[model samples]
Target: YYNAIMACGLDSQDALEIFRLCIYDKQFIDTATLKDSQMQLKGRAASGVVFVANAALSVASITGDMSVVSEVITDLSSIGAKMNSESIRHIVRALGNIGDCEMILALLICLRGQDFANDLM
Candidate 1:
């Protein structure tokens, strides 16, 4: 996604808005309070590039097809430290829909670097 964004020679911010409009043109998430999302993920480029993580997570959760994004999810988790707290939170919440213990173990591996406190989690 970021690659495409860069390839278009866009100024990042404007291009994101334009891209969102092109994709979610008919659908709106509403301007009301973002109770479930963090504002930081709006523009924060995790992995020093882009965190299209939200799009990947949403597709998996909404479609109830974990396989749709399992690899991407794992990649995101593997580089969890490079991501913001909100991005990781998004991944966890999305995976929560699956309620799988294997995912817990996978997340634990990533969370280990985040905190020994998380060892209790």
Candidate 2:
């Protein structure tokens, strides 16, 4: 539910705070009082986290917000979270859109070993 909102390019302090909660505090869990183990599954809870990452990348690319992009990258890296190939594409496209040398270096270092050669070339 929350992921849906964020994926639509909704930028707000509340959204970022909740994103941090999901990444650092494991915010997503059983909403009801039952505390169902299945509902609280780590993978299930993290499903939205990936969506948020993808969405954030898209927003960063369009808005050219280096700080936002850096924050997302740092948050994902600190947690050892892996982005899907689509997210990588977004990062590459952002490099083209924003042309930030620092971001290029940081992302290349962060994504070391991933086959982004075709995109770079």
Q: Which regions of candidate 1 deviate over 4 angstroms?
A: 1-49, 73-82, 115-121
Sequence-dependent TM-score of model 2: 0.55
- In candidate 1, where is summed lDDT lowest over 10 consecutive residues? 27-36
Cα miss at 43, model 2 (Å)?
16
How large is the C-alpha RMSD of every model relative to the true structure? 12.0, 6.6
| Candidate 2 lDDT by residue in tens digits, 1-121 | 3564366473633444555666654444222213432343232233445556666766666656656667777887776655566566667666777677787778777767755433343
Clashing pairs in 1: none
Which whole-number lDDT from 0 to 100 does residue 101 have in model 1? Answer: 62
Q: Tens digits of per-residue lDDT for model 1 on 40-116?
A: 33324333222444444444454344554455545545543234554455456656766766785687686786643
